[model samples]
Target chain A: MHLVLFILFGGLCVAGAVNLLLQRHPINSALSLIVVMTSLAVLYLLLGAEFLAAAQVIVYSGAIMVLFVFVIMLLNAGEEERTTGSKAAYLVGFPGAAALLGVLAFVFLSQKSALGNARLGSFLVTTSDLSRVLFRDLLLPFEVTSILILVAILGSVVLARKEQ
Target chain B: MNPLLTFLLLSILKVAVVLVIFLTAVAYTVLLERKVVGRIQNRWGPSRVGPFGLFQPLADGIKLFLKEDLMPTGVDRFLYLLAPMIALVAALLSIAVVPFGGGQTYKGVEIFDIADLNIGLLIILGITSIGVYGIALAGWSSNNKYSLLGSLRATAQVISYELALGLSLVGVVMRAGSLRLRDIVAVQSVHGMASWNVFGGFQFVAFFIYLMAAYAETNRAPFDLPEAETELTGGYHTEYSSMKFAMFFMAEYGNMIIVACVATLLFFGGATSPFGHLIPAFGGAIVQAILPVLWFVAKVLAFLFLYIWVRGTLPRFRYDQLMGFGWKFLLPLAIANIIVTSLVLAIHG
Candidate 1:
């Protein structure tokens, strides 16, 4: 069952990514991005990271993508011009892609035992357990990250505010 | 029966039953709103269709089904057609995680909700976030200025309110110490009304903030700037007609029901009776299964009535006022509520 779901959503993720590139309209591309994110969340679920899956959907696919779609819609950026590849692009692109793929495959092969048995797959981390890890074990990082976000928000507000 | 097959069949059956009941409730909620609002305005509402207009929804359904499905000129055909379905599917998906009755299993299958997940509340939040796409896409695809503006307003409003909505629930999550709807309810089951988050938990501020934010999130009245008929016509659904328009309508009412259900579960102890142990279990397994469900439905109905009541009495917010209220007032208040809740919990513990 898990394998079936993995194949289904994994295929969907790849298909959405391809569609995102092929789509001309900015809105259409944004929507395809949402599909890719949602499908990736399903993949996260297949690995039994339920909390991560929910966060992926809520924060990334749900919130961030809504902002992307909203901005695209508001701007009404017209469809992109269809352009064939430049002569220099097809030359360097293929080998670069191949090298990247090669590196990924090498890393996966090296990590096969750990991926098969432990943290990478077939383990459920309940919400409570995840919360403890975040609050207790990773408290400093979480607090620092939040403070960084607070600073960024304050900067944006200051920039946007008008002087009376 | 084989275990997997039994589970599959039972689940299909559960989904079918719950969906039918939910759609029926959505339909009647429209009738309920019209009737209640009419009475509030000193007029009769739809009394000719059946006994007290009970079959009015059936007539309305038939009318919508028979009406022409239109695709206006120069619209994005694919997203235009897909938008209402997206709206409806996202609206319906969250119910699978809301526990409507006891944690009872028959033949190794959960009998209350369809999918028994540990992250039920988060799943609902995620689905709601996705629900925004339906309205946003509807407006952008329509090729109409009114639709575009309406959807734009909706997108901004939803995004702003969503932060407050999610934060308001943190206090409840903190009190319950888990994300499961069942656990949230169980935390409030100890002394019934007293133990409810609003009363014993001293999270009334959170509850009120949740109520206002939820109202905005569902895009219902007072906060319903998206579809303000006075200015935006039909809003994001302006270009829709026939069953397509009805789909948006259903999605709106469906969202309203979800907001109500979540409020009931989080603050009012869900399907658990307010009377707690004052009322004994009255009958066999069937009755036991149904009693909590009855309590759940009654609370949801009360919330729905409150929805209609506010719609009738209150006026729509100006766009700027709506934005300011959500961001400046509600957001800070929700944060304050969270801080107070956490501090109290820490000190008491």
Candidate 2:
């Protein structure tokens, strides 16, 4: 059951990624990105990271992607003009991608002995438990991350402020 | 009966029953709003069809079903069609986790909610956030400037208000110490109305913030600048007609009811009677199951009535005022509420 569900969402995730790359229209691509994010959230849920899954949807697909769509709509961007010929990129890109995939597979295969199998649906980490780790054990790091985010927000506000 | 088959059939039957009741409730709520708003304005709302327009929703549904579906030229056809379904589905999906009554079972199946997951509150928030897409996409796909502007404002308003809405709920969650809707209600059920999160938990500030943010989130008036009929011509659904337009309308009301249910559950102690168990239980198991549902419905009705009253009374906000109120006022107040709540909890403990 778990494997089937994983395969389903994983396939969907990949398909959405491909569709994102293939789409000419910015809004269509943005929508595809949302599909990718949501499907990834399902995968997180299947892994028993329910909090992460909900946050993933709420933050990524919900907030961030909505902004993406909003910007696309506001800008009224037209479809990208297609160019037929990029011979050098076609020759180099495929081999680079293949090599990357090969390297990833090789690393995973090499680490297979060290990596123990995880039984699906057996592992569970509720939000309370995760909070315990974040709020107590790693409180400093969490606070620091929040501060970093605050700084980023201030930076964006400063940058976006109109000249007066 | 075969066990698996029985389970499947029972689930199917349960879903169908719930959907029928829910949709009927949604339809009537619209009628109730019109009637209530009408009465507020010193006029009869809809007395033409069925006594006092009791069947007005039915008539409206039929009219919408029979109308021509007009597609505007240059509209993005796919997203134009998909948007309403997205909105309606998100509205319906969020309600699945809301517990309408106490745990009642038939053949080992829970009767109230479809799924009472532990992360029910988060799920609802996530779904509500997703629901924005329906409006945003509707505006963009319509190929109309008014639709685009209305949708952009709506998208911005919803996303901005969502921050305060989530923050306000954090106080309740802190008090309950659970994300489960049922658990949150149970926390408040101990002392009935007195023990409700709004009163007993010292979270009334949070409650008010939630109420305001929720009004903005669900696009209710005076925060309803997105569909401000005066300025935006028909807003996001401007290009939509017939059943398609009806779908967006239904989605809006559906979202309103869902918001009302959440308010009831989070702050009003859900189906638990305000009088507490002081009123002695009487009658058979059937009555026991029903009494809570009655209480729940009554609370939701009160909330809906409040929505109507506000809609009738309040003037619409300017776009700048809406944004300023949400960010400058509600957001900070909500944060302060959370701080005070946490401080109180820590000191008390």
Best by TM-score: 2
> Candidate 2: which pairs clash?
none
Q: Which stretches of model 2 miss by more than 4 angstroms?
A: A85-87, B1-7
Tens digits of per-residue lDDT, candidate 2, B1-349, equal 8877876787788778878888998999999999999999999999998888898999999999999989999989899999999999998888788899989977877888777898999999999999999999999999999999999999999999999999999999998898999999999988778999988878889889989999998888999988989999979999999998998998999999999999999999998889887888899989989889999999999999999999999999988999999999999999998888899899986
Write down the lDDT of every candidate, Cα atoms only: 0.93, 0.92
Give DockQ: model 1: 0.86
TM-score of each model's chain B: 0.98, 0.98
Position B160, candidate 1: lDDT:
97
Q: Please give the DockQ score of every candidate, comma-separated.
A: 0.86, 0.87
Model 1 ranges with Cα > 4 A deviation: A111-121, A158-164
Per-residue error for B206 in candidate 1, Å, reads 0.8
